[model samples]
Each structure stands twice: as C-alpha cells, then as structure tokens.
Target chain A: MATNRQIVLDNRPDGEATTSNFKLVTSETPALADGQVLVRHHYLSLDPYMRGRMNESKSYAASQALGEVMIGGTVGEVVESRSPKFKPGDQVVGMGGWQEYSVVDADAPGMLRKVDTTHVPLSYYLGAVGMPGVTAWYGLVKIINPKPGSTVVVSAASGAVGSTYAALAKARGCRVVGIAGGPEKCRYAVEELHFDACIDYRVHGDVKSMSKALKEACPDGIDGYFENVGGYILDAVLLRTNAFARIAVCGMIAGYDGAPLPLQNPTLILINRLTIEGFIVSEHVEVWPEALKELGTLVAQGKLKPRESVAQGLQAAPEAFLGLLKGKNFGKQLVKLI
Target chain B: MATNRQIVLDNRPDGEATTSNFKLVTSETPALADGQVLVRHHYLSLDPYMRGRMNESKSYAASQALGEVMIGGTVGEVVESRSPKFKPGDQVVGMGGWQEYSVVDADAPGMLRKVDTTHVPLSYYLGAVGMPGVTAWYGLVKIINPKPGSTVVVSAASGAVGSTYAALAKARGCRVVGIAGGPEKCRYAVEELHFDACIDYRVHGDVKSMSKALKEACPDGIDGYFENVGGYILDAVLLRTNAFARIAVCGMIAGYDGAPLPLQNPTLILINRLTIEGFIVSEHVEVWPEALKELGTLVAQGKLKPRESVAQGLQAAPEAFLGLLKGKNFGKQLVKLI
Candidate 1:
C-alpha cells in the first residue's frame, strides 16, 4: 500500500479562514475494490466558493465536515486501476479534493472524466477549459444573453471565470468593461483580456467614486453584468445599469465572512427593470458539453488565454484560497500539488 | 362647446405628493379634427405608479409635464367622432388622463380600444380586466411561473395587482401567502381572495419580526414572490425564500417618498440562488390578449372579484392618488369623473 497525503478541515473560521483551520495527515491507501481506480493529483483548483462550504450553513453544495478532506477540483492521472474502463497513465478530472491521491469508483455516476490534453494543457482543464470556463459561459451566454454592441461589465475581471466571461462577451461584439482590484489586474483585463476598459476598484475608496469611474468607463451604460464580488461593487453596478438590464450573480466573496452587506438601493432593480439571477454552475450540467467544447477551442486558438497564480505545494492551498477571497490573486488560484 | 374639468401637475413633488401640486382647471373642449374623437371620461385610475410620474426624473413613461393634465389610465365613452372607427356610446379604454373629457385621435395606434362592458363592467377596464390585471398576470404567470403545491407570497395583498396575483397563484393550486398592512386587509386576503394564509405586516414592527412571522406563515418556505411593497417587507421575504425561488418586482412604493430603504440581507438573493425580475406591464404588450382573455373570464365568472375605492369626482383624483400611495385605499383606487 502507498502513502496518501491529505488536508482536512480542522475547524470552522470565526470571520476569516486561517491556516489553523486545516490539518495535514498522511495515511495508507486502501486496497482497490472491484471497480476502483487510484488517482494521483497533479493540480488542485482553489476557489472562493470553498469558503462558503466551510461553514455549517446550507450553501449550493454540502458543507465541508470537520475532519474530512477539503473538497476541490483536481486534474490528475490514474496510477492504478482494477476496472477495465480506466487504465494506468490516463489523465482525468474530478472532485479529487485537496489531496495527493484519491481512490475513485470507476462505475460511480459523475465520479471522473478522462480528458484529452493534446489541444489544451492539463492544467487548463482545471480552469478556462473546465468548470470556471463553463461557469462564465452559463452566466454570459445563458443568463445575460448579451446583444451585439451592448455594454457588458464584470467584477473580478482578471479571475478565471471573469476572464472567460469577458472573452466570451467580447466575441459576441459587446463593449466589455472590467472592475478589478488593482492597476496590474485592471491593465491585464484591458490589454490581455481585450476588454474595452477596466476600472481599478482599489483606487476608488467608496462606491460613489467607483460608480463615477464605471460611468466614465461605460458611457452607454451597462446592459449586462457578471457579479463575483458583491457589497459595494454590486451597488455601483446597480446605479449604472440601463433599462431592461440583466445581471448574473455568480459569487459574493465579500459576504462569505458572515457579515451582512445590505444593498443601499434595491429599488434601482425595479427602476431599471432589471433581471438578476443567482445560479450554481454544477446544477446546470446539461450545458457542460457545449460550453467545454467552445472553451477548449478558445484556449487552443489563444482567444481565451487564462493567467494562473500557482502556489508551490498542497500545504499552500489554504493561504492561496485565503488570498483568492481577498482578491489578492490576479487570476485562477491553483495549487501545484505534484 | 362643452366645458372640460382637468387636473394639471401644478408643480413637481419635493418628497411626498400633496394636493397643492395639482390644480383643477375648466377649459372649452377642442373641436374635432379629421381623425379625432371626443371621449367623456367615466373613471380615472389612481395608482401608486403615478407617484413616479410626479417627479422630473424618467419613469416607465415620460414625466407628466408641470401644467398639463396628469397622465393616467381611464375608462370612458366616445361622445362624438370624425372617423368611422368610433361613435357615440362606445365605451373605451385609453390614457385619458385626470380629466372629465379628452379629444383623442381615433386613427392613432393604441390610442383607444372599445371594451365589452356587458361581460365586464366599465370600471373593471381600469382594474381586474385591464392594466392592473395584466400586470398581476405577467408577474405571477410569466415571471414567477409557480409550480403546483409550491408556496407563493405576495405583498400589498389587498391592493389591485396584489389581489389579482394572490388569486391567480391560488387557482394554480399553489399555497398562497399574503402580507397586508392591517388586520382587516389580512383577513380580507385570506377570506375573500382565498389565500392560504395572510400576515398583518403592521403588527410585525420590524423586518426581523416580520421574517419570523413569514417563516411561520410559510412553513414549507416561499417558492415565489410578487413584490409590490419593497423595503422591510422585501428584506423579510428574502430571509424566508427557498433555494431557487423566483421574485417578480412590480412596485416599490416604500421608496417613492425618496427615503433610502436599503435591503438588510441582499446576499440571501445569492445564497438562495433566487431570480428577481422587475418589469413594466405595457412593455410586454404581446401577452395582453392572453392575459386579458383569462382575466376577463375570471371577472365574468366572479372568480376574480375586484373591490374598488371610488373617489367622487375629478377634483378628488389627487387626494385619492395620494391615499393610494399610503395604502389607505382598500382595493383598486379610482376617481369617478362623471
């Protein structure tokens, strides 16, 4: 039996999650069952949504139990297989969690999927060609339903989901505006992601100032918005949205700390005749095949280039995840577990 | 020439609208043109939406110009006509404003429509079988799309739109809950409208208490909401909404006075994966035929009995409208111009 290294949820956070909340443990891998495969993870995808799962409240997904492996997306290779379906050396993607190895049942529904890394990189499977990309497609293409020549705005625009959303909206002939935290990320959003303009939210101390900047960035007013960071950013966006605007609420990283962040003027939603929807990407698995195909093609053709903030080891995932919640990471925050 | 009694917008409102902002005037009726028809107004609809038109800012329709007849929905009879399309004694519905008479173009598109007063009463053209009815149908049927056995909630439950909405949701086999201002209105909603339960929002005091009451009223959790009164009521509803719940935002009368009423927990919108949409009924004119057919049949069969708070004359229009905004009126507030 081989040794497996895993990080488990030690405790729930009071306000902000710290390194003490997670504990590392090493254990012997159990013998393979009749239809089991052993997967050695190479990359662990850390996301802001994981913070929502740490608490005991009912989120979109199940809460992460104490003393259990922290849930995550992973791209890994099948090292051993008892089932004929999955053979050794086959690269796969699944909920492999924050661990070096996972014993998966090959016959289980939605357990794992084999990926072809020839066109797109293996790491991209955890990002632009994977869940985040699909999430952007679902929000932009399905929810927002952007019309050509319309103005579309996104928050946290340099992140994995935001970057893909901007690219997808830009492809549909929309004037894309990004709201990012710092100058570097804003510049990347505008220059690299091909957004028409990017507003650095850090420079604007308050929502009023940020709204002023957003008004300048989108002269025609925002017709659609992909919301990631809630709080003041959402308030500013609400003020600038045009009549009959649509907003897709993907994440509210600001409220994950458990403090209540109220909207100053919810009446704007009625005043502007807006449609705002909050959705979980996993719940919409029907669009995965179509979304992944387009995303994979975009990445392969260099039309959707995703930047990564790679943490060195599995031990760095907690810190990387914490940084992601604070908008410290420029793009997709990943842990190179290999 | 006959004299016309009209109410003009004397001045824009500073905060709350007053009778001083309106001026009653008598003028000689204009001579009929080649495509013209003279309409003798019978009933002038008084609604909360008129409050938005009182301000200089843009509303769903253009602002009512300060020294013109206050724009409103009216049911009337054509007394004279130059065109072959209309004749005397033909009861019609149009934007006839706050006046005893209006000279309208008979050939103009959407200017007038002859209503069947035999099946539905003339006053109902301004309430149950008209714009308010369509507004209710659009929000409840089109937007919320409630499922059978689901719990649907509505605010301003005793008012025109809200009453129709509660009835419609109930007819679809939904468990309907209503939030009304007083004990009388709440009892009326349950007994007259056949709502499963009704909450007297006045007694609840605050949003937290209201939310507690809501949780008790909707034991299975709220699946859909027809939002008429925003502010604390909206906050309370958000707290009790089930996952994937839908809300149709029709009106926010609480904010019409210009006081900022922030939502205390808007993040619940995201947490519960809710879809909230704001819509203007007229903007969706395509659904009018279907909506009106159903509404008219319901009225004729007495399944949708609409109550009225009729003010005496055109001089009573401003006071009636002001009262409507304050929830003083029992049901559809209307001014009998005859």
Candidate 2:
C-alpha cells in the first residue's frame, strides 16, 4: 500500500476563509487501474478563482463539496504507470488536487501535459506559461482588441494576468495605464511592466480623479479596458471611455465576497457607445497552443517576464491563497509541494 | 408680425424639476435667413433625453443655457420657405425647439420627414415611427441581438422605447417579459403588446423578489434585456442573465435626477458572461432609412402599433415634458402645436 498526505475541505467558509477550512491527513492509495498513473505532486497553483469554488454557492465553475479533497492544478512526477505510453519518472502537469500522491487515468480529459523545465522553472507551468498568462493574452488580443496608438487601461496590473496584459499591450504599441491598490504594486507596474502610467486607487480619493489622471497620462481617452478590480474603477472608466470602446470584463475581485456592493453608473453607456464583455479562459482552450507558443517566444525574447512569489511547502497553501485575496502576494502566488 | 408662445428655462432646478423651472413667454418671430424655412410647429415631441440637456453640466449633447428656449423635436408646416426645396403649407419634421415657430436651414440633418395622417398619425413620428421608436427597434435588433425563442426583458414597458422593443421581440418569436411601474402598464404590455409575461416592479417591494418573479416568468433565463430604467431593475436583470446575454442600455430614468445612487453590481457580469452595450440612435443615421422602412411596413401590416399621449397646445409643452419626467404621460408624450 502507498501512503500519501491529502488536504480536504473540512468545512465551507462563512466569510473570509481561514486555515481551519482545510484538513490535512494521511490516506491509503490502492494499485492503479489500467492506463492509470500514480504521480508525486511537486507544485500546486494557488489562485483567486479557487476561492469561489470553496463556497457552497453557485459560481462559474462547479462547487468543491465539503469533505472532498480540495481540487487544484498541480505539476508532479509520475512514480508509477499502468499504461504503455507512460513509464516511471515521467513529469507532467495535471489537476492532481491538494495531495502528495494521486492516481489518475492517463486517458482522462486534460489528464496531463508534458513539461520541459530546461527553458522555464517547473512552477512556470502553474503561472505564466499556464492559466493566468493566457487569460491576460486571449482577453486583450481577442476580446478588448486594441489597435496601435489605442489607450488601454488595466486593473491589478502587478498580478499575474494583469502584468501579462500590460507587457503584451506595450509590445503591441499601445499606451497602457494601470490601476493597482498600493504604491508598491503601482511602482512595479510602471517600472517593471513598462506601463505608461499607474494609479494607486488606494491613494486616489475617487474614480473621477483617477479618470482625470488616466486622461492626462494617455491624452486619448480609454479605448480598451481590461477590468480586474470592478466597482468604482469600472464606473470611472465608464465616464472616460471613448466612443466605440471595448471593455474585456475579466475579474471583479472587489465583489467576490458575499457582501452586497453598490453597482456602477449606467448612464455612461448611452453617452459613449461602449461594449462590455465577460469570458473565462478555459472556454478558449482550443486556441491555447497558438497563444502558448506566442507567449513562450515573448518570454524567451525577454519582452515578457513571469513574476512569482513561491511559498515552499504545501502547508503554506492556505496562507498563499489568503495573501492572494488580500493582494499581499508580489505576483503569481504558488505552493511548492516537492 | 407672427407671435409665438415658447417655453424658456426659468431656473435650473436643484433636484426633481418643478413647474417653476419653466416659463411661457410670448415673442415675435425673427426674419428668416437665406436658404431657411420658417416652420409653424405642429406636433412637438417630448422625450426623456431632454431632461439631461436641461442640466448645466455637459452631456453627450450641449446643456440648455440659462433662459434659453428648451430644445425638442417637432413636426411642423413650412409656412415660409426662403429656399426652393421647401414651400409654404408643406408639412415637415425638424428640431423646432419648444416654440410655435422657428427658422430652420433646409439642409439640417433629420431636418424633415413628411407625414401622411391617413396611414399613421403625425404624432406617430413622435412615438412609434421617430426617435423613441427607432431607439427600440435598433436596441432589440442591433444591440440586444436576440435569437428566436430566446427570453427578452424590458424595463418601463409602458414607455415608448420599452413597449416598442417588447412588441418587436414578440414579433420575432421571443418569449418577452416586461417590467413596469404599475399594473395598468403591465397589463397593457401583456394584453396589448403581446408579451409572454410582465412584472410590476413597484408592487414587488424588493428587486430580488421581482427578479425571482421575472425568472419564473422566463423559465429559460434572460437572453436579452432592454434597459430603460436602470438601477435596481438593472441589478436584478444582471443576476438572472444567461450566458452570452446581451443588454441594450437605453436610459436610466431612475438616475435622471442629480442625486447619488447605488452603483451596479459588476461581478454578475463576469459570472454570466453578459455583454452590456450603450448606444444612441443618432450614431446610426446612415441606416435609419432601412430601419424606418421595415418598421413602417410592420405598422402598415398592423403587426405594430404606435401609442401617444397628445397634449393640446404649444404652451402645454412644458407641462408635457414635466409629465414625461414624472412618468405621468403614458406611451409617447407629445404636444400637438397645430
């Protein structure tokens, strides 16, 4: 018998999640069935969207039931294989949950992807070269559809998705303005991401001033808006949006918790002919290969940089997720389980 | 010398506009300029957008200067033509302002469209066949983009734009539900406009309950929302929108006053993948002729009906406009200046 550690959802959270929400215990694993692979988990991705799954309410994705092992994307080494295609010591990325070892059918949809760590770190598979990076890329290029000389505004510009969008938009010849919560992230957005301007919403009194600052920075009013933090930021952007503007509605971290927040002003939509659209990254999986190839080259060419704040143990996953929600993480927060 | 009675802005109101904000003044007509036609205002159109123009602050259109004649759209007779294109006794429509007579240039855009009282009343130009009418048509067909059998919802269903959109969507094989303030309007929306169902938001007490009622009426969830009165109604609709839903944002009658209101909840936008677009009819002048032709044919076939509340005289324009802002006037509010 093989023994491995697993993290299960002990209880659903009331408001903000705490360490008590998760329970870590040892579990016995049986022999793998035909075409099955027993993998040793090495890294786990800690993300904001996972917080939504922890709740028992409705979300874009399915709910993580109470008492089940917490679901997560992981990169691991295959210790045992029952299929001809895989042998021992094969490295792959899969949804292995929060477990030291998992038995998965090799033929399962999205079972695994063979990763080459020579060019990038293994954790890169859980961040920049994976879900978050492509989310920013596909959202900006395909949804917002910015043209050269277009004024682009992005929120949470130091985070994984927003940083990717800012760098890509800059390379595409667009003038990018970013909005973040603190001065440190604001400085990082401007200095490292090469954004034309950055506004610290925490310091700014209101969105109207932010709009004036954005207008001053870009000269041309916002033509494309990559929304990450919704609420006042969205309302202010609505006022400054030019005619025929496109808004890629990405994330609304401001309203994710179960509080009843106020809504955005609606009249701006009529004054400026604006189109706001929302989408999920997984919905565009078929086109991932092309997006990944382009993003990889950009990374290799030093045009795009992947920033990560790696927490060096599975026990730190809760803190990592908490830090991510509070915007305390420097960049893409990840947990290393190896 | 011809004498004209006009409504002038007495003073800008602080919040809800009062009768004291306007004054009826008798003035002598000025001589017409070259290539200009002197129009005797026959049918003055009173619209909700005029309330926005009354403010001293800048809007999509210029604000009404102090003591200036209130701006409005009207159908009139070309009693005195200084140009060869128009002649005396010719009935035309133009921006005649809120007066009995005005000198208009022959070449002004939306300058005039001749009306025949035989098929549809000249007031139809103020209601179903004019700006408000086209607003509904374009919002439903062009912006909302509803598919056959899709669920559609409209706010202020007794109002010109809302009623027209509901009627048109019903004609296109959609399951239409309308939100109105009173039972009378709700009854009319279902019994007359042929909508599948209607919700009286005022009677519901809370938007959540109304949203539940709306969802029950629309078992499949909302695919299209024609937003006329934004605020709680919009927030409720945001909660119930199906994936890939489209919102045609026309006006937020609830926010017409200068008071601060609650912002829209944006997280619903991301979870449902909603597309909310704000548009004005003037932006699509090139396509107006096509839309008008199709809408006129529908009216001629009795598949569409135009509704109007005709005020008796030019001096009554101020009261009519006030009535429109208060939702007192049913259907399209118009002043028959003839």
Candidate 3:
C-alpha cells in the first residue's frame, strides 16, 4: 500500500472557476485486486475540458463529483501489476486523474495503453500523440476537409491542439494561419510551428479589428477553421469566410464562465453558405489510431515539435489549470508529480 | 411588341425595408430574337430571398440592379416563340421576374422548363413543385439526413418550404414537429400539414418560453431542424437539441431587415455537437431533377397539399413582399398577373 496525494473538486464554480474550488487531499492506494495494475503517475495533464466538468449544468460530459479526484490524463510507469498485460517497468498512459498514483483495471479495454518512447518522449503521449493530437486531426481532416492550396485558420494557435492543427494543415499543402493571445505566441506559431501567418488576439480583441487582421493574413479568405476560442475570433472568422467555408468547433473556453458568448450577425452563415459543426474528440474513438499514427510519425521525424508549461507537484494543478484558462500557459499545461 | 408592367428596386433599405424603396413602371416587351420566347406570367413567386437581393451587400446572388425588373420565379404560358423547342400556349416555369411578360432565351438550357399541369395546378409550379419544394428536399435529405423514429423540427411550418419539409419528413417515417408565427398557422401545420405538434411563436416569443414549449413538443428531443427563421427560435432549438443534431439553415428572414440577430449561447453548439449548414437552393441545381421528381410524385398522389397567399397585379408586388417578410402571409406569397 502507498499514500497518494491528489486534488479534488471541493465545490462547483459560481460563475468563473477559482483555485478555491479545488481541494488537495491525501489517501492510501489499496492493495491491487486481480487484473489491476498500480501506476505511479509522473505527469498529470491539465486540459481546458476539465472546466466544463466543474459546472453543474448539463454538458457533453458528466459533471465532476465533489470530493473526488479531479479527472485528468496522466502518463506514468507501472509500479506493480496483477494483470497479465502489464509489467513493473511498463511506461503507460491512462486517465490516472490528479492523484500521484492510480490502481487501474488494466484489463478493462482502452483503460490503459503501453506506449513506445524510444524516439518520441513519454509526456508527448499526453499532448502531441494523445487526445489533443487526435482532436486536431478530426477537426481538420473529417470536419474542415480543406483542399490543397486553401487557407485554414485555428484559434489558440500556439497551444496543444492549434499547434498540431497548423502543422497538419501545412503538411497537407494548405496556407495555415493561426490566432493566438499575444505576439510571442504568434511568433512561435509562424516561426516554429511553420504557420504562414499568426494574428495576435490581445491587440485585435474585438470583431472588427480581428476581421481586419484576418483579411490581411488570409488574402484568399479563410476556407476552413478549427475553433478553440469562440467569442470575437469566431465572429471575425465568420465575417471573413469564403463561400462554402467550413468550421470545426472543438472548444469554447471563453464561454466556460456563465457569461453569454453570442455570435454577432449569424446571417453571415447564409451569406457565405457555411457549414459549422461542433465535436468532442472522446466521442470519436474510431479515428484515434489513424491520427496517432500520423502524429507519432511527425514527432519522430522532428517535423512536429512539442512545448509544455508544467507546474511543479500535485498541489499546483488548480493554479496551472486557471492559468491555462487565462492564456498564461504557452502550450500544453501539466503538473509534474514526481 | 407587348406592354409589360413591372416593379423595380428604387433604393435600398437603411434599417427596415419599406414600400417606398420599390417603384412600379410600365415597359414594352422587345421583339423576340432568334431562339427566344415571350411569356405571359400567370403568377410571380414572391420569396424571402428577394428581400436579400434588395440589399447592396454581397450575397449568394448579385444585388437586384436599380431601375431593373425585380427578380422572381414565375409560372406562365408561352405567348410567342421563335425557338422550335417552345410553342404558343405551352405552360412553363422560369425566372420571369415581377412583370406581366418576359422574353426568355428558350434555347438556353435550364432558363425555361416546359412543365405539364395535367395533374397539377399551374400556380403550384411556382411553389410546391418548384424552387421552394426542392429546397425543402435538399436540406432534409442531404443535410439533416435524419433516421427513422428520430424527431425533426422546422420553423415557419405553414409556409411553402416548411410545409413541404413537414410532408417529406412524415413520409420518411420521422416524428415531425413545427413552429410558426401564430396559433392559426400552428393549427394549419399540425392539422393540415400532418405535423405531430406545432409551437406558436406569438405566445412563446422569448427563449425561455419557447424552450419550454419545444421540450413538450419534442419529448424525444430535436434530432434535426430546418431553420428558416432565426432569433429566439434558433436559441430555443439549440437548448433542446439532442447530441449530434443537424440543423439545415435555409433562411434567416428575421435578420433580413438590417438588425443584428445574434445567436445567444453558440456554446450550445459544442455542448450538443450540432451541425448547422446554410444553403441557397439555386446553387445546387444538380439535385433539382431528383428532388422535383419526388415532390411532384407526392403532390400528384394527394399526399402533399399546397396553400398560397397571392396578391393581385404587378402593382401589389412591393406590398406583398413586405407582408411576406412580416409573417403576414399564411403560405406561399405570390403576385398574380393574369
């Protein structure tokens, strides 16, 4: 048996989430049952989706229960195994939550996966080759379905999903543009991520200004868009869309707080003959294999690079998550548990 | 040569369209060139799309040029013909505009189609078996693509497109519900159009009230929707949409008058995983033959019934179109010139 330290949901958010809503707690990991594996999590991923679970309202996923370990993705090493599928030294990825250790039913299909880290690093399974990577793939390939030589844009362009999306679009012969919070991230998106251009949303905060920048960045007009931030950026993108443009909506982090995020002049949908679809990556598991293959290959070839903003220890998870929501995190946000 | 009375766009609307923006004038139908036919219009179809054309802004089609004959669909009889393909007294449907007569290039493919009215009324060609009917077909069959036993909803359910959609969905073995302006139109939708239930927006004008009504009407939740009117209706439907619901947006007449029709809670798109697509039926001419065949068969079988609110003479075009925009017309709004 081992003592496990974790963060739990203390209460639902009133409007916007704060660090006070989370509570750090201690528990003992019980002896493993048959078909169970004891995992020691080295890193816990902090994603934007966790914010939706904190709300009491009905959302795509079930609400996070109070006094429970906060739901999250984790990469770890198996310390002990009662399941035939795993061994003590196996490096694994699973939903290990906010706890330092997890007793997983490894035999429960898809509950845990053993990943090869000879060429790709272990933590990248949490960002570039995991859920975030597959998300960018589905929205770009299945939803946006851009043609070669077309222009495609992604919001939160320097973050996990957007960075991956920009790279994927560029690889597909598209003129990839990005929308990020500030100049530093914009520079990273264009310079490092190989985006044709990136617009700084902080300077062009409103729809009119953002539309002007988008017009300049996408001189041919935006043909497809992967939406992660959905307030003024969405309105601006809608205004600049070419005829028959498609939008794949992955997240609306701006609306995670209770304030209404209204789309100004939705009449543009008709004017532009647009198609806008929303999706959750978890629901579409069929494409994960194909997506992960592409992502893993790119990372191995040094074509797709990864960046992370990691907080130290489990207790820093809440602050790191809050920072992620506020655009303080530069890329994938995570908590180092070791 | 023949005297032809016509309505022309005199000016564009500043905020809301008014009758003063259109002018009535008389013209002489010029002598037909080779491969041309002169038609005497029986009925001119006044549709919501015309309101969009009156604006100077870029849209699916070009703006209705100032001092030119207002664009419209018409059912008429050939009065004179220089083309071998058409003869005098042949019934036809074409873009005859808001005039008593038109000189069309008969040899031009798709410009003029000779339609048989042996089992169908001549005026029905401008409605149930024409552009509006084909429009309803494409949105439901191609976009929404609902399954049997799924619940589909449509707004403006007593109008030309909505009524046809209600009939088509009912035929497809789906639970069909509708929303219209008043109790009378709602009654017509449910009783005459065979809708399972109908909501009256006059009573449920706001999002909260409309949402409650939709919950009761669509107990299984809305699986698909044909969005003709946008505003509170769009907001209410978004709240009640089932996961993976599809919305085929044909028009947003409520926003046509230059007022901002902001979509409240666009975040619901992500929450519900909805797909909303906008289209102009004229753009997809490829589907017309298949759509028209099905619509024609249903109408001839007495399964599809058509209702109209037609104004008399070319002079009434402006007033009738304005009335159609205000939900004053019960069904298909048309101007009868004969």
- Model 1, residue B289: displacement in angstroms? 0.7
lDDT tens string, model 3, B80-174?
Answer: 99999999999999999989999999877889999999888888888889999999999999999989999999998999998999889999999
Candidate 1 colliding pairs = none
Best by lDDT: 3
Model 3 agreement with the true structure over A42-145: per-residue lDDT tens digits:
99999999999999889768899999999999999999999999999999999999999999998787889999999888999999899899999999999999
Candidate 2: clashing pairs of residues: A263-B263, A263-B264, A264-B263, A264-B264
What DockQ does candidate 1 have relative to the true complex?
Answer: 0.76
Worst-scoring 10-residue span by lDDT in model 1 chain A: A53-62
The candidate that achieves the highest DockQ relative to the unseen native structure: 3
The models' CA-based lDDT, in order, is 0.91, 0.81, 0.93
Error of 3 at A171 (Å): 0.5
Name the regions of candidate 1 deviating beyond 4 angstroms. none
The digit string of per-residue lDDT tens for model 1 on B1-338 reads 47999999999989988999999999999899898999999999988888888888756456878999988999999999998999898999999999999999988888899999888989998998889999999999999999999999999899899888877887899999999889999888888988889999889979889999999999999999999989999999998999999999999999887886898877787788999999989899999999999999888888999689999998888888888988899989999988
Cα displacement (angstroms), candidate 1, residue B238, comes to 0.9
DockQ by candidate, in order: 0.76, 0.53, 0.82
lDDT at A208, model 1: 95
Instruction: Give lDDT: candidate 1, residue A191.
Output: 87
Higher-lDDT candidate of 1 and 2: 1
Tell me the lDDT of model 1 at A26.
Answer: 91
Q: TM-scores for all candidates?
A: 0.99, 0.92, 0.98
